[model samples]
Target: MIAEALITLSKPKVKISPFMKVSNSSNFQVSEFILKGLPGIYSWQHWLSPPLALLYLSSLGANLLILLTIQQEPSLHQPMYQFLGILSIVDMGLATTIVPKILAIFWFDAKAISLPECFSQIFAIHYFLAMESGIFLCMAFDRYVAICHPLHYPTIVTDSSVFKATVFMVLRNGLGVMPVPVLAAQRDYCSSNEIEHCLCSNLGVTSLACDDRRVNKICQLVIAWTLLGGDLCLIILSYALIIKSVLRMNSTKAATKALSTCSSHLILILFFYTSIVVLSVTHQAGRKFPLIPVLFNLLHNVIPPALNPIVYALRTKELRLGSLKLLRVHKEYR
Candidate 1:
């Protein structure tokens, strides 16, 4: 009886589910997570799939058209178009990183995401967003140089310089945003496997961690502000200088043309940053309406991408003409 009592004492008092695994440290780790997508609309969630998929398809189509237009047009082989091409690629990546999985959750009721996949999505989402911000900053600088120092623009914004800037943008954002997912994955997620958000955002996944997630939260905030906020500030400064230079132009026609060139970029910037600000405010204000923030987050990922090429095409004569020529050529070939 004493031996049996000792055996009983040796056994763990708590029951561990088969779904969870014991790590080397003997902590129960979650292997999968359930994404509770858009709270309080379970029955009608499927209705969202159509519109969401349409947005995704539209983003893909429009961005692809932009890329094709840039690639095929010899006249557009300039730094501006090159940066626009990069922006299109980043926008496509940003939308793709999360939207499909969201669609799956809505369409097929596939809400479970493996732990590794979830973390990967987290990394890709943040990485692409950072890249987009970096591209925007580069574009702003490009505009500033073109407008404020037209003579120096040719020397400063050369093809080689654009290539170097693109490389830097890729490397900086990749290295900078990598820590977010890595840090989130390191935390012990023993408390819950149900993520409240539609996607595996750093905050959404980390909030379920049983251990203190203050570090994760702090890391995300610091990285976000450092990357996104820093880029926005620099962009604002660039535009301010551009405006100052534009206002000084003696010819009103020249000033209007210069400002017209920047209008499309400014519109895109507003769309991207405004969505981010609204989402942040919604979260920080502790708004009781959960769906509002989720909708904003979804719109932020899809709307900018869908609108980017369209906005540029509508505002920029070169791109609009080039797109028409490309379509005509394709039609002729067919």
Candidate 2:
């Protein structure tokens, strides 16, 4: 009823996006106008959101538990745990940014996101995404410290250093996305903001500009390549050094122990980076599997955070036992 009411009451207002410089651009006239909410994407979201919401929420819960557990138990307050907590926060922020909005469309067919909202989503998602990649790089460095500089690790990765690194990432990524939305505002609107995807994705939104999107496109290209490329290079280098160190270990048992710790990190790295590479290479290249790539992007964007707890934290004996202990203490008191 609310959806129907909102849809009926809300008359779509027409305005030119600032970046769109097309002459005579107005509602419904531009070749590729960014539309405010259309019902088409919403129709599909109805059937698709429940399962996705479950998975995202589950992951959110797990990550929150992990963060809290690490904070309460002093033993877990090392650099590694702090970095893991930062990652959990970023993952939670990243998933919440995209999924719930889509779910709302499914529940209520009011598919109209204002231009401001669209820009907001773009800004938030990209910022967190950059931060997520940066965080992974930090994780790689953490692993490198444990393996390569075991003697000096305590000094190198102190809690103060971890705090600074987390702050810098959040600030840097948040600032890094400024050009996207700021440039998007210049586009002139022609009233066709009907994005095919259920999300207010970056490229999809950018393509709506009636004016030359060269500025925004360059920003996207620069940020994508810089962050993605930098992360990949660092990860590879870290692994190479790690392998070298592990090889030099005197005892097989010690080396095996080191490798075991690495196994989970490697799995996550593969999942996150490979998905990114595949998505970037295939994006709008008119590849045969556009929908498939979207689904994979969805996975890359959300599933890592959802599966992260299970993949890295929940599987750990210490975290698991600590969580159970906390739960039992809470239940007994209740």
Candidate 3:
């Protein structure tokens, strides 16, 4: 009996089933991701490279010029132009975050991104995007104060206030987006390591995981709606109040001035939100034509960066003159 008991103990109380599935995801986890770079347009990725590269170049040049102009012309250092300066930085960062990788994918077919690099890219992309969203909200508030309460604008949006707001924006957005990558990192990506997008977005990568990603998906959605949605709501509210104030002005010139002050910003805002909305819609409803959404997503990131500075320069007289002065100085130098 003693021998049998010892043998039974040695044999194990229950036989282990070799056929049973054991989730050793760490062993089978994907080490790298193959960025597919726009489904159904595989043959034409080459053609898309030049335009995208040009867009990135334009964004970089325009934003750099804006930064230089703002720095050189001390008079351009008000809350409005200061906000534009911040926006330019955000736009440049956004373009820089994705465009290089996109060009590599399009031109060289260098689509495989390792897990760590992929996550890092995700962090940067999300961080800048969130920062841009918050900056726009700040810009809207600046406009609101300028147009609605011009008398108190200086007091409310002083250099000190702008500095504090910028600091808060940086910290809030940076901290808010940190969790997105962490949640993505926690997911087991053993199903397939192919990302359907040009970049390693939180949604695109998390969708490739084999495990239950409900939490990841839900967290991403929550973060998006909370940050972007909240900013958008406040922007709309600020504009609404501005419009109300503008309408109350009896002078046509005053009304026109107020509306004109908002026109450039509204254009950029429209471009930003329209692209996002169309991209989201294409994802849900235009699945049959995948290229449309993919291109929209790329455009959404690249075009705003390129066009924002141009729009602002064209609309704002000070910026236009500053650009001209810089051009003259360059001509004189050369």
Question: What order do candidates take by lDDT, descending?
Answer: 1, 3, 2
Sort by TM-score, best first: what order?
Answer: 1, 3, 2
lDDT for each residue of candidate 3 in 154-174, tens digit (9 for 90 to 100): 799999998999999999988
Total backbone collisions for each predicted model: 0, 18, 0
Enumerate residue pairs that collide in model 1: none
lDDT of each: 0.88, 0.76, 0.84
In the predicted model 3, the residue pairs found to clash are none
lDDT of 2 by residue, 163-279 (tens): 898888878777877777777766665555677565677777767656677877888889888876788799999999999999999999999888877777788788888878778
Residues forming the 10-long window of minimal summed lDDT in candidate 3:
13-22
Candidate 1 error regions (>4 Å): 1-27, 285-287
What is the alpha-carbon lDDT of model 1 when measured against the actual structure? 0.88
Backbone clash total for model 1 is 0
For residue 255, give model 3's deviation from the true position in Å: 1.3
Where does the lowest 10-residue lDDT sum fall in candidate 1?
A: 14-23
| Residue 263 lDDT (model 3) | 92
Best by TM-score: 1
